[model samples]
Target: MKTLTAGRLLPVLGTLLAALLCALGPGAGSASAHAALTSTDPASGSVVPAAPRQVKLTFSEGVLLSADSVRVLDPQGRRVDESKPAHADGKSNTAVVGLAGGIADGTYTVAWQAVSADSHPVAGAFTFSIGAPSKTVAEVTTAEAGPVVDALYTTGRYAAYAGYLLLVGGCVFAGVCRSSRPVQRIAVGGWITLFAATSALLLLRGPYAGGKGLGSAFDLTLLGDVLATKPGAALLSRLLLLSAAAVFLAVLFGSYAREDGDRTRMERRDVAYGLAIGGTVVAVGLAATWAMAEHASAGLQSWLAMPVDVLHLLGVAVWLGGLAALLAALWSGEPVRRAEVQRFSRLAFASVCVLVATGLYQSWRQVGSWGALTGTEYGRWLLLKVALVAGMVVLASFSRRWTGRLTDGRPAPKKQAPAVRAVQAATGAAKAARPSRKDKDASPERAAQLARQREALEKAAGRRQRDADEGRSGLRRAVLAEAGVAVVLLAVTTLLTGTQPGRAETEQRQSAASGGARTTAPAASGPAETRIPYDTGGTNGRGTALIRIDPARSGNNSIDVSVTDPAGKAVDVPELEVSFTEKQKNIGPLRTALKRTSAGRWQATGFQLPMAGTWQLTLTVRTSDIDQITEIRNVKIN
Candidate 1:
């Protein structure tokens, strides 16, 4: 029985030990994640001759612009912009600010914090020189950013760690607890901890991602808005999936455990429960990864990018949790059926493999190039995580070999005792006749006794080997330790994802460019020459007025006029009037003399100008003798 037990456990122990070392290694550090800033306006640092009338910013995705979306400050740090920032031309992704009049010649810094349509907060500041400006004023105070948001962010991470620990611990307890009652207690605690952690994450999402908090928790309007945004939609979908998983777990706990079932039935129940719990945890992990990617707005169809991320997170949870359970089984030594340990070991091995594969793919996608791995903070952290995972694989391999050797049953070597001498006269006479010194030293009785001792030594060696195998339970301890390290790595990952990666570098590049200035020469141009003529077909208020405009260049020109009420039964007091720029002016109280020529036409020659550029036109229409309507049209000259 001892031999069989030792054979069964060696493999499991070896695998766990390897995993622990991997978790503690630098690879764990490299696996952190976060969003990156792609671009900004004012080109980071720039110089302009005059104060611009407005400031505009464009982002990688659509953004929601409101009163606090952006702020402009003078060199002395005084607020300059008066009106709240608004979406430029109703574009959701662009923010525009109207500048106040007092903006003088000086260096001005534009500090902006925009909430992406996906609910992620992105902030940046740029210095733009206004006529060799120097003083700076509009600084972003940390308090205005809100304390609740920061606290929520920190708490959410801590809760994730706690939840992970409880989950692993519960799995361990379930594997090894002698009493069903203790197993139930551990399971319940695990679920409760997981629930609390997930809830914390949900609450923190709003504030950390630039939302208003609990008031918006159940706001259907906010939900609708979130759905409209890609990041928000993805997160909401993941949460719903997680909720479904939670429901499945509840049902399994409430109904499945109560059944007295055969092995097959029990196995089915176990699978169902595992799926439910695993799915929920996986969904939560995917959502976290999405938040880290910063491309939350990519929509649900971004499966090509998201699947690896989801798999990476889910695989980590399964591998870590399984290791904990397996370790606990080994530690208890009793009550842990060997078959159960073997089953769990197989599952854990598969999970570790999956984790490694998905992690590699995700790392490739995020880091982009080997240079980024060494040059960027995100890349460095990812490298650390990869190293840890590699170490875990090596450990798992060693354990697998140990388990195989133990499980392969082999009998202990046989022992034989020397035959006892026959007490015959012939044998005594033979021994007396050969009584030399050598014969005395190598007596038959003594040789026979030594043979018996050799057989005993072999039996003792077998017993000791069996005991050593049973006592060396390092694998289980190593697995549990690895899981704890994984928790810390995950926390660091969360923090890295929260920070902006290339903001400082971008700012520096902008500053260097602004230091140098250049000037360009204006081109010379020609002069303007014009000619005009007027004619009348009749003398009465009903008469036709003709005017022509002939430019020296013989190109397109325009004419305009203002006319008063004409006293005529046919004309109806000149109710409607139209005019073009650079044409006839106010001609009379009753009529205006503007017309096209034979060389041009008989109509208002300059009225319908054919050219490219802005062409201003004014129109007046009288509703009644006392009431009138007037409008100006700055038509596009092109």
Candidate 2:
């Protein structure tokens, strides 16, 4: 966009990016999910009276779950959940799995692993029981993603973001802001990068979500599955938009270069309107893809959030991208038009305003509360982003102040060109040949030679100075520094998109806060239940033993133990015994004999818990007269 004489093309692309930013919020699952489990059907620690038909899990944002992503295991190591995997609905957050035909009454652990929208593998588990909240076999927590997958996925996103800025920035800034070939070339490069990255993301989507290596990235089934998702559709839309923008840019930029020939050519207004305005409209339309796919579409007041995000993205493109284009022109040592600098200044200021206003809203929505700001990973990244933006503004102000020198209607000083210096040398030689008033001491011929030598030396000194200084243009350097900061800011934004949202973290924190309180209350009055699984060595002896304590108090309590195999069948044993030992007090192992209530079930009339402590319970099973085995389990006797 080298049409330097007129407001050749309007700066409409800025509006597009600014709007995109405003419409898109950053976090967990393409900003909506951050991969946190939003809700569970029975709730994390809720005690359901009877087994539900299915176990339902809701993510904060949409996620990709594999076939084995969910599981329900009983105390006997028997899988009580169906094997058929369930995928989350498109643009939806929930997933469900059917419970097996019959689940014995005891604690059941539901362990799950799913891929978030950001393409990171995450896992977690929750426990619920049929009758009493049986003691859990093990409290399985959240699983972390592999580092290689994280790094590769992040690299792909970074490339995509860079491409976005380049394509939009080049088209808008080079066409309207500064109008330069350097900027156009940069934009074209951006277009190519965008295409490549989009393709990479498609391939990587499978491996990313499946938690597999790069080898599995090209899985056709996985790719098809991802394509059916909200984020997938958004990415595909971006590719289409990029293709359209490329065509528009090629025709628009090529026509101006070929037809105009010079800045004063004054391209017909109709031609400019058809090419430039239409192209910008297409670019702006493309921003909707990002807005629809990200956090803006899912969080609070999404209707308003999407529009605001669009404006924000537009502002960033115009301000940051325009600045980069301006830096290119300045580096060429071209006489930068004062008016254009002023136009950019005003635009930058407006962009900052939009960014500040929209950023505050997004932060509030995603962050939830003040405590989460310091407590959550998402909050910390947001703070860093703000700090970076603030620093960028300060640098931008400096760039604006530097541009003021150009506005003073003075050209930047430069050493004489070769032609002018040659003319000066000839003139000096003519004067030196005659006896000038200033230099009358030497002979005329000697003075002529001295003058020639002096002129050569002057030229040599200027060249040396230019070389030593590395031909640096201070005006260019200052603006370029601001552009560099913009790159860093984009990097932080990319990372932020992969992190958990503060709102979700805040909810998790609240859940944790209330968990202990629930545990202390009686099961008769509350859903506080614990189910622990234990295994003895031999096949016949290896079975789960269930224990339920009502008001599991500090005095006498009725206890029952049911032994079952992996197939969910009750197994009979010759003898069954139960005992408890407290480590803290180093107390005696109070033992008791249990009378068989059924083939594999035993019951005791009275068992005493003298105090509250973490107790180890051992169950001894006698498969035959001699072959006996025992399993130990830890129980929180609060």
Candidate 3:
């Protein structure tokens, strides 16, 4: 029982793995492209030293200005930035926002949306305070997307990918390698699945992007919005490519399936040639849709990256999908030729080499560093994909060994078992009826001849059973196992497609290093956040001023001030200055010149406090050209 279980384990595992692969392939079609916020002039959560002329944003990739939108508002939700389309600077990913008028003191929120170079739409918002944050009416209302909607979107994408592979693999397998009924069926199914998946994704995009629930997937209004974008356009292109592929597939299957191969060899050869040329062209066009709508067309070196990604997709389809076809042929209750297996094996090897070369380039481009492989979600999934593919390669080598057995003449033993059983029956009966068995040599009586014949038949049947069962190698088991592991690899590949790339972190860190206060003196790092409010008396009367100190607590801090009326209305004060004194340490007053950022905001940076203690800060508020009032406040630092 142990031996039998051990012998069948690999094949059982293979079948199960294929099933899991089928399950995994559909969800792997998550957004291949993801956009990360790189940097803004006033960093997210950074208190600027002063209000700026304009808000500048730099992303990791060049984006579509028309499809992207940006908005900036003060604490009162009054639009401070111009309400118009944002534009990208020449050759740079930076988007510039023109200020509508002067900005006042308070927390300001910048909400933005962009269609990245990879054609995926992404959005986010961030806040920066002036003197301090006020009761800002601004909110990040888009909120977290529903999990069900996300899952459905991802599943639809993966389904399309799976369908693409099946259709493409079936063509390569049937046209060039060998023809089989089961392979054709798989190819046909692939076409249908691809069509369905594309339709579903096209409909789902609008709702998903709008942050609507799963139930809104069928919203026609949203669908129209999706069709107007790049992702939708890519999917539409894929459908057209699939339609062309269907025509080629029909021709190949029809010609190859005819029984009179010898009589119409030339016609079939022409069809095969057509498949090699036309099919590849169609496959490349189809693959381009994915690449253009994915990471390959975004971020760094997009032009060169796109071609590599297209090849990578094609290689994967041939290798992984071919394995699936091989499994079908093997279990088709017909002889699988050594020639067929060897042919596929060679092609599969070349495909794998291409996959490796392209995959390495992609990994380097997306991950950026070795640490990111473990540090980022995308990296971790890539690791899993590599490990699974490695396991499948090992299993495939074992299956290849089984294919070699076809030439070793091992199958002859089962064929000869019946002939050997007939001879055994005659010999056994003669021996049982001999005189030597009954007396000394045992001779059998004529009256018991029928019983002796029956005993001999039983003995012969048992011997034949042993012969037929014995030495029947687990070749089927190896193939099944190989197929199963390959399927799992496809699933892992799907997951990697949907994950966020690690390169995003590398870009963001670099952007942070060069932004805002981080570029100056001891202010190389942002100051801690602290907001202090005080009212300056006059006709601008009892208004609240918010003070923001970056790295606010100790060391070097950058100061910003925002003045607003009690009700949070902008009050453009004329002149404002701040002085810091560490009184307990007997430190003299250190005055920093204020730079006007906007009408209500002032910035002063690069003031280093030598010690940690309670510091007295004085704000000289000039309401008019002549009248100035001083407001004093104490701030503790450690």
lDDT against the true structure, each candidate: 0.46, 0.63, 0.66
**Span of ten consecutive residues with least summed lDDT in model 1:** 515-524
Task: Give a tens-digit lDDT track for model 1, residues 364-431.
Answer: 44444444456544555665665555455545555554444343222223311111122123334444
Please identify model 1 stretches exceeding 4 Å from their true place: 1-45, 60-66, 75-78, 86-93, 101-103, 115-121, 129-152, 161-187, 202-243, 261-303, 331-334, 401-475, 499-638
Write the residue-wise lDDT of candidate 2 on 135-228 in tens digits. Answer: 4443333333245765777898888877777777666665566666777777787779878988888777667666667777777887888788
- Report the poorest 10 consecutive residues by lDDT, candidate 3: 23-32
* lDDT for each residue of candidate 3 in 159-266, tens digit (9 for 90 to 100): 888888888888788876678788888788888988899888887776666666777777776676777777888888888888898888787788546666465678
Q: Is candidate 2 or candidate 3 better by lDDT?
A: 3
Better of 1 and 2 by TM-score: 2
Residue-level lDDT for 199 in candidate 1: 60
Error of 1 at 337 (Å): 3.1
